[model samples]
Target: MNKSIVAGMLALALAGCASQQPEQPFTLTVAHINDTHSHFDATDARLELGNQALFTRLGGHPRLQSHAESLRRQAEAADQPLLFVHGGDAWQGTGYFKLNQGAMNADILSRMRLDAMALGNHEFDLDNERLAAFIGGVDFPVLAANLDASRDPHLSGLENLRPYVLYEFDGHDKERLESMDDAGDDPVVAVIGLVLEDMAEISPNLGELIFEREVLAAQRTVRALREQEVKHIVAITHLGLERDQRLAKEVNGIDLIVGGHSHSLLGNFSNLGWDQNEPYAQVFTNQDGRGKTCVVQAGQYAQAMGRVSVTFTPDGRVSQCDGGNTLLSDHAFFRDIRRAEQHRLAGQDAARVAAFIEAQPNIALVEEDPALRAHIDEQYKPALDRAYGEVIGHVPVELKHVRLPGADGQGSRVAPLVAASQLYWANTPAVQAVTGRRADFALVGAGGVRNSLEPGELKEGHVSLELLPFANAMSIVSLTGRQVAGLLLEAINGTLPEGAHTGKFPYSAGLRYEFSETSKGRGYLSRIEHLADGRWQKLDPQAGYQVVMTSYNASGNDGWNTLYTAQQVLTDRLDLAFVDGRLTAFPVARLSKASGGGTQVHYINQPLECNAEGVRCNTDAQAFIDYVRDQRPVLTELTPATVTLNRL
Candidate 1:
């Protein structure tokens, strides 16, 4: 009775076996850069040849152009789809950035022709209007999915930026979709963007614009892309390698993350053999705990451009992922890469391939883009020469400014001196002549100082780029001795971010203090003395004192709210402040505006121009310049620093 049924089942099984279609492999290649940070041209760097060392320039807009074009050609020859992605932070960190305010970067990167980029924290360095202007300029999509910028007039009406973008593969057909046809086989890739969440903490200009958590935003963006039947989601993020690693662990559906902000060297490298950077791309398991995610970053300042090749099964699961950083400082690396690919495709034997690699030149010069080079050479160079070439002063030895281990007491000694420089700015007769009140001490933050100086030369350019790249100006504020003491404690005991040091350590003027780490939380301030009557005596915590600090610190958004004099004056959290600029302590507004029409501590964003403007402001670099030029003949090396817990 079952013979006919068995025969029927056999035929059905054969039909099923014959109808099954093997999974087609989807291949994609992404060439990416992150933390481009406005160092538009290559600078001199130590490069490693096979067995020799050479100092040469590496990376600039032009080299990137030529290399990327070569990469595109290679990808096409290999029959792989190629994408160019940027991970963000193309703002700040150079004289070009200061002079042009990211205009050059926007122009240069646009010329490089990016497909997508995430919004970096530094993009908000300027006002929203400026950021909107930048967004208006980029031809490719500028993406930030965590925040809703539609309500902000400064960011709304921008056509170039969006939450996500869909990039259809080369063979995509519009005719297939227009006919109401069931063409579910379109090769569409979705790229989502994520901006860093700590913008409010790092810079305060974001102002009332709220950012959603990264995981939630990612989930929603992925869901939306899935709804549109888009597979192979790539999250281009400005959240740095550390955050990106956490993201890979937490989020699903993202095949890759091209990241920035920490300026991490991900994957492979060439150079003096920077051995510390992570391999060009790090692989992690997928969210379902089965598939894989590849995370890559192009080192900051365009030192390298990363290329990642990913293969996905037709069902949108990752199959093979290979990536490494291209050290643009040396074109030889890229040439070898091309050669290796050519040989592999040509079926060259391993011995022949190794011989070919050995025969390749160790050093290859990167050709400059002529027109851009001329503009930089003739125009930008001349401008820099005029402004920064002047010898401002000399230093006996290199002023110590390099960041040390977190436990090191002298994290950045020049930072303390930068703090001391503020005293010279505010205590001048100009302030007494105009405001009738002069500042007694000043605060300089260690985090704001960017570079260290060498022993030989001290140009205005040195002060400009190293000391004041951020262009933060002075803010005069009022504080009591207790407030000052509390500020120091805030700097020393502020909550450290994950894998970050406490950057708010105050470098002071006209005062010295001592405290112990063991006794910090129990009672941090052991003794704080100020120079009174030319003698170092106990600082009166109750006595009112005038203080000057950079507006970056005064904004109360530098992750050191307790250091803000307003918090001490009003005894309330910064988040509780209203538009009226008063703190609501115990649900009551207690802050009274100073006589000059600002906060109780008198918030002034302008440079201190006492005679002409009544009040004045001095940028950090300018203050360093004026102080070194006028009072100090030679900047000297640091005296040995006792540990902070011993003496701060």
Candidate 2:
């Protein structure tokens, strides 16, 4: 009587077990933005006039917000969980952010509703104090797993920012169809932020207070999330693509990595159906023994927005995935040629959200007031007066882009001119106020010259700082003529990479030399030459020559490690002191006088000397300065000007 009943009950129990199997599929969407360098304004009307209609508009927070909004809407319609994130560099770039230390940009950015953001290197461009002021009211959390914020007095309060956040979303039930759509299981999405460790070295002044950590921080963060039972993890990274990939490969449990810093336009690394053929390529993962990790980054300046859609089963394994990126600047009506694409992208009616970023009210913290701007712009007499001296001669116009004599395409043209003036000024009465002696040899590094004088009618006070604009100190160093020749050779033969050649190396107005690009080793600089009488002559390696140069050069910053190798006959004299006591007195009058009437510069290929006897064949005054001003035209002086130096 009991056997049939017992068997029926067992059968019912087995069927119930089969019906309880876990759900096998789920979908999530990720929207990534990076490197929005505080460009607030939109297009200019003048740019809209001509052929400007052909190009695409680019960058503005509002455009990015709009793109993000569009992505969110699509995700919501598709019944997917949407996560909006940033890769970093939400700091200084334009007059807007720089004017307020990112306060202005942050105010606008906070309103965009980002879930999480990584810290880019430029975030440290402002001191900790300004950084705090800038990010004080940010709504969303910033994740920087690598920055040791405790050491910095200015950044000490940043410890409150969460290192990562696990977002929980309830998925809608597909079974319930339209009516029961609200019923679903809760899913945990973990997001971690990371910054590069090299920020300290790259941005010394801004990061002086904090030290950066490395991959271990990321590893620890992932482990912590794992402990919290969160399996789906996304890393918001500003450590660059290479490092991001390495992190993905080394760390287990990282589901996706959104990267920045290299300004790359990536989609999916493999054929996950993302944009594979475009110039923009998304970096993928080691595939967890399967295929690609989901890595994506929109290019810099909010020019594009990246989207990744992933299908994950209840088993925590991603089943199927597909995604694409939309170019914010490629839409119609934004193609005005005369207008700046940035402004148009920010238009109120644009597809993306409008960025209502306002200028900082505390102007004193950002830039000088109008009066100060005018003071520096119209009449910088006090600053200039405290720099150089009374009028000497006068330049009819500013002499920009000066180079060393003879060292075609390799040496500096402007440095030599300033060095010449400083050395000449040292031989006068005002010199006693500083070193109490006339200058010997002058040396100026390539990095010192910040601006070039645009060709125009030179005027008094014009020479004031139309040339130099840095903390560079004018200095006098004693060098054997042989040492001077070696320094000149090193300055001419730079060690730049393959494609990074700028005509910014080389010596100043007084020096010159030649270089061979194809030669092995330091052969980049060849047959040494200098300006003497009215022609170009060979540099005598044996003679002891005194030269005036910048302190930076002597310290070896611009690939001039060879300079200090020679005997340090003497140094540490303050060239700024000379500039102060002598040059600062006359300001306008001194600048004009020093320019002197027109100096006729010429170039002669006739080669001459290295010895005291060969001095007779030197180039003329105008030829010498001309040779030093720009080696491009002095082709025949030293080595050919076409032998280019590449940057590594």
Candidate 3:
């Protein structure tokens, strides 16, 4: 053979060997969202930057939709395979979603093309049947690994929806498939969905028709998916970041965990900095134990979208994973409400979405029920109307329950007046005379004053939902003065300075306290004095004295745990007993008979005391007017005056 022929053959063999080598790895992108608690509009007024205020910009559904579209387009143009997924809590919160019962929001989400979502606890706020209707309304799969929806006849039909889904795709950048060496490699991916177990306790209404198991249910599902040769596993969890980190550390087959629930805007897999009470996890690992699983949540509402990109080798493990959270609101910019309003008004003539909602079908009651709802409305509506509209005293102008910083601010008048009224009602001879048989102390939480009245022309028949939206009726409960002070201290300690002064402290008809607004939460109540000896005195926490307060305060609704331990000796009284009745029942032609006629607020110089137990009070007033009306037969009065309001 010739030497030239041998050399040409060797060159041909080398070229063929180089062409047989493996190609570059394929890349995958997962776009996730969670805890979008129906923050459809920009409601939060106080915002700076980087904080939750960023949400105020792109929080709306329209802005969020536009952002998602742009990102999807960008990913497609880049030749990347993008998957859109949601962790859970797609609805509830705010008057918008609550009034509509999630129907409109669900429609918007369906248009958003959410590929998959986990069933959140808020979904059940409308109950089982409505949830079934909502699930049917959405095109995407709502998966919950441990939810046993078998008992709900409306949900049992969805048994085909698996706890996890396995997707096998030809790995290629959607834009430039030809640029990648392993563009045609097929990789199998498993996506599992997990719901928080505590949802059963917190959102009992949503989970009442179903039961949730722990992470073990997810483990079993992952094992099954792995058995089918699906190696790249991603768990869309509604169990929050802590549980997600814990699951990643404990679970063996999970490749990555997309977390939701405890709405933290997580950017990386490290220490969670915002929460101070608990220790942060040092590190979080992926399914392979050695690798790290990227966990993230896009805060609440559709404020932002999570973008995660990971490269995978021919084997079932992940390779270079890189991505960052995108603040979509940066472009939408909802901060300038005036600008948004202009834009929104300009777009009002635009075409509406082409969708139809069928008329609601009503279910007829099978049993003949008594007029319970009517009875409740009839019993409570008048009391609410009188409390909101009736003129308790002769005010120079109208006063409102809430106040803003300005000349028009009347919260001061309303607060002091109401405080004085409750104090007088509790200690009046009639109230004291009935102490052994009924509530001795009357209390009111500040948040209960749902709405405020306007100056001038405030008239009758005005009170409605705005007056008391929470359905929290005024109530009276008996407690010792020591217990009362302890409760107040606890509230003052837990509340912000402003909140402690205006809303945290329980208002009582028999007690008074002088607090400084500049003091920190715990030290806010610098001097607490009760009215006695025609004067005020410092309060002692150990002394026992009878007291009365509102039901919300006594029942521990607003972090008032101290009240719960105060020994509830009495309750179940009409909300208007002391204040409304006193203002209206006064005989005509008398000074106290006129509106604003009851105990007027007058700041005192020192503290006051009352009772044999040496109970004391540190407050702005020395004496509270007693309106007991002889403590015998309960005096009843009816008035025609009422107040009205528009809640928006």
Candidate 4:
């Protein structure tokens, strides 16, 4: 009520705002989401805090929309420029993807009103035609500067894709980006798209497309943009954090890098030894050593959004940067779990628990947007509801699967579940119909599996969580016992790209081998055995056998390339053939169905076109669902008879 006090308070607030401003600065706010992976609805997310793992609800499209809207409002109130960008991989994780291959995500993301998105590796999971179609339906620009579309007829026109986009904004809304309160001449900002170079190795869908080296492609694009008088360049990149950092240090002209693909969590920079929790924005000196380039990647699954506030000089050079992740730690549900843990730790004390719960930090969670929630209820819930209840099988015990590093990030111990399932499908009569015999063993790459089945009841929905993210068809391949040994050698000890990990470590079923982490190259193998008549027998190199595996590995993704190319394995290799349960070989059908007609196709390549009628091929998920349904309760445990023994 005191005028003098009110005036002083107003003056102090203005001073605070001005203190954050740099001379000749153009303050811009960026709201970014990445690797959403179809978590269109809220899900329980786990967090590892110091010594305790906590559960919290994270990510629903509505909540993400609400958060972004709030950012837009905040930026508008501050009279600063704001941009909403998605870092891609909006498909694959949820039942929404399994329903119609991510069509709903496209509609939902468009409704969120995103300006642009980088091309993520998982986008290629749908194959070229489907991906092209998905892009055609999206309202925003899909970016990837390094992807050469000449190989695919559908992608040759470069429709729905841009190497880069230039956008101008002001109060006048000349470019229609949005409004700035105080009208002025529109300032142009350039956004370039960069893809990971090893995309082809990761997804068979990209096998035909050529990718440019990230740094070189960026350098060339930055020069071209600079020539056009575009300043303040931001690269929307699918390159994981490491490559993005290298791109920043190796190339010049880029002002900022918004990245995805690694699902990295950036917060604390000092703990470089751990994978997550790096500083939100890493500052790197451009190659010119004149200006700084700031790189940021929001952690995956739409669980968090990265907010970046940048102050740029009038000359279009970055002057200062600040921001961090806004995690949606909903206390509504997870608090109950916390209470249980608390009560267990301290003997049952209702009053104490109540007091403790009340004493907890009142961190508010973002509310889901009503409109988006309504849209999901109307358009998505029906299918999702059915999927959630559809039974797949029963598990005798929990099959734990997490990306926890074993052998110091070499691989995960949980990979065996994926391998065992692959072997199960391979031994099926459908597989026998093709190879004229049942598969003797199976192998799968560690990274291909997204999650492990928990103990108890399994459903079609659970399958989506465990294995659907890949969209990789199941398949069988015939190889001599010698080739199997050679493949194992190549996987563990071969010369992988610098910084590439053995996360694609092989997990074999019906075969056991002992290897030490200390071994290198061919020396990695110590002892190996095969299950013959449920008996462990020494692997005979001369014998022939059928193997089941993900189509991803069969097509030579990760380190599988070494196994077949004679680079790190035995000299001879074999050809792949297409087979079905009907004892028929549809070579042409398989070509069009899986690997897009590649030289080597996997046995379980699914959603295929089998007959002239154009029937949809069975997907790997379907095969798994069917296999599990028949078995009812599959026991999960490691016994002395378990395959793939690691000394580690």
- Per-candidate TM-score against the hidden true structure: 0.76, 0.55, 0.52, 0.79
Stretches > 4 Å off in candidate 1: 1-22, 46-54, 171-186, 267-275, 330-365, 378-380, 395-410, 435-440, 454-456, 481-497, 501-545, 563-618, 642-648
What are the per-residue Cα lDDT tens digits for candidate 3 across 1-648? 999999999999876643432245657788877877665543222222323221123445555555566667887777666778888877764334534556755676787777678877567545567777777888777778877666556787773244765555543332212112332335556677887664432332342244456567877887776665555777788876667777877777676677677665655422211222222212366466675565656666655567777666655556666555543422222334333444331232221110100111110001111242243235433454454444322223334454212222212334444444455654555544543333333455654443443322223222222322222223344445566767766764554433122345344443555444443433445556665665556566666554544433444545566654443333222221223223111111101111211111111222111111333221111111122122201212111101111111
Number of clashing residue pairs in every model? 13, 93, 43, 8
Q: On lDDT, who's better, 2 or 4?
A: 4
168-281: candidate 2 lDDT, tens digit per residue: 665421121111123234666778888876453244244334444657887788777666555467889987666776776776666678888866666432221223433333
**Model 1 RMSD vs true structure:** 9.3
Q: Which candidate tops TM-score?
A: 4
All predictions: root-mean-square deviation over Cα?
A: 9.3, 15.3, 17.6, 9.1
Error of 1 at 268 (Å): 6.9
Worst 10 residues of 2 by lDDT: 585-594
Model 4 earns a TM-score of 0.79
Which of the two candidates, 2 or 4, achieves a greater TM-score against the reference?
Answer: 4
Which one wins on lDDT?
4
Q: Assess candidate 2 and give its lDDT.
A: 0.51
lDDT of candidates 1 onward, in order = 0.65, 0.51, 0.49, 0.66
- Superposed by TM-score, candidate 3 places the C-alpha of residue 68 at a distance from the truth, in angstroms, of 1.7
Q: Residue 473 of model 1: what lDDT?
A: 54
